[model samples]
Target: MASWQQIEDDNPTFAAKVRSLFDAGTNKTIATLRRDGSPRISGTELKFEAGEITFGSMSGSMKLLDIRRDPRVAIHSPTLEPPADHPEQWPGDAKLAGTAIEMPRPEGDPHEGAGYFRVDVSEVSVTYVGNPADHLVIESWDARHGYRRRTRK
Candidate 1:
């Protein structure tokens, strides 16, 4: 797992693109595991701040309860459809799989009773249409394999 700062330090350009995609959308999606190990997808507000990818859930929320029990999680930035006329120009979407460790409440938090967590990223990635609209491209990074790319026609 890597910290947000480590990712930025390793590849500034890649990090910038990831951050831009996340900023392009308002509500991202988070997947949490239920007690039975089932997956639950929830709409969430996410941010890249204080050198971490972070989010919070309101007190007594299912997500908060889920995180407390199991920290593993995956987050996907909101998506945007590519323009049919210029499909290759789509900026793509950002995603990460990580463990969300609970953090102490920050001073002056508006969501006073919310649970805050900072993700320790296991993998980070993005997907977009290749130029010429020939195929889909995935760019990814992980602890085991620093960076890699794959394409599908």
Candidate 2:
């Protein structure tokens, strides 16, 4: 089987799924680990482009601080169902697991440390929604499919 990056590269539709959630959406609930080995959760608007995901953060944000101590994290994307008039049913839920890295931010970019965390996905899954293979369900207008940016040719 091909790798996630390879599959996403070969299929525009799959790539669109990852992009739709990162863009347009106001927040992504990111789960990370605290120093005490407890779970920590936070939400942030993220930017996904060029096969990379990025988000802003402050110097002392718990999420940022947690990432500093431990990089592994789980991310959840709230699936948006389309309206009834549409032809396809939107996905009910989805998730991705990966590592987070702090990118150096330029000076004066709001919070410190570039105010962003980048996640490199190692695994992705969709559950509770009808099998995605049925393109008809996804194509429906009533189903609120996750948002996607216009792809460049």
Candidate 3:
């Protein structure tokens, strides 16, 4: 897995675009695996700081318990529908998948009881509609593959 900083260093432009998508909204979606291996989706707020992506769950939250038991996770940036008159104006959507690393909370911190996890990104991707014929464009980065681009009609 690669850290967010590594992706940024390797592909600055693509990383910037993905970051912008995350910044465009305050709430994102996170997926986690339950004990029985069922999928669970939860609303979350993402923080990109100190070259890392992090999020915290409220004390004793199910999502917190889920992450503690299974770190594998996927987070999707907030989705925004294109304007009726300007479909091409959509900023795009982004996703990140990785294992979450629990971060230690400082003593007496305001949210010390909450659970925090730092993302160790295995994959990152963004999709958008291109100009002209509006071909679908997909750009992705992975620790093993580095970077890739694809387009479809």
The C-alpha TM-scores of every prediction are: 0.95, 0.67, 0.95
Estimate, for each residue in 27-127, the C-alpha lDDT of model 2 and write its tens digit: 77888899999998888666665567666666678877888889888877754665456423554345677778777775666654534667666665443
Q: Give the better candidate number (2 or 3) by TM-score.
A: 3
Window of ten residues with lowest summed lDDT in model 3: 128-137
Residue-level lDDT for 88 in candidate 2: 37
**Cand. 2 TM to true fold:** 0.67
Candidate 2 stretches greater than 4 Å from native: 1-7, 22-24, 79-88, 107-110, 131-153
Off by over 4 Å in 3: none
Candidates 1 and 2: which is better by TM-score? 1
Superior by lDDT: candidate 1 or candidate 2: 1
Q: List the residue pairs that clash in candidate 1.
A: none
Q: Residue-pair clashes per candidate, as listed?
A: 0, 23, 0
RMSD of each: 1.2, 8.8, 1.2
- For model 1, state the Cα shift of residue 88 in Å: 0.4
What TM-score does prediction 3 earn?
0.95
- Which residue runs does candidate 1 get wrong by more than 4 Å? 110-112
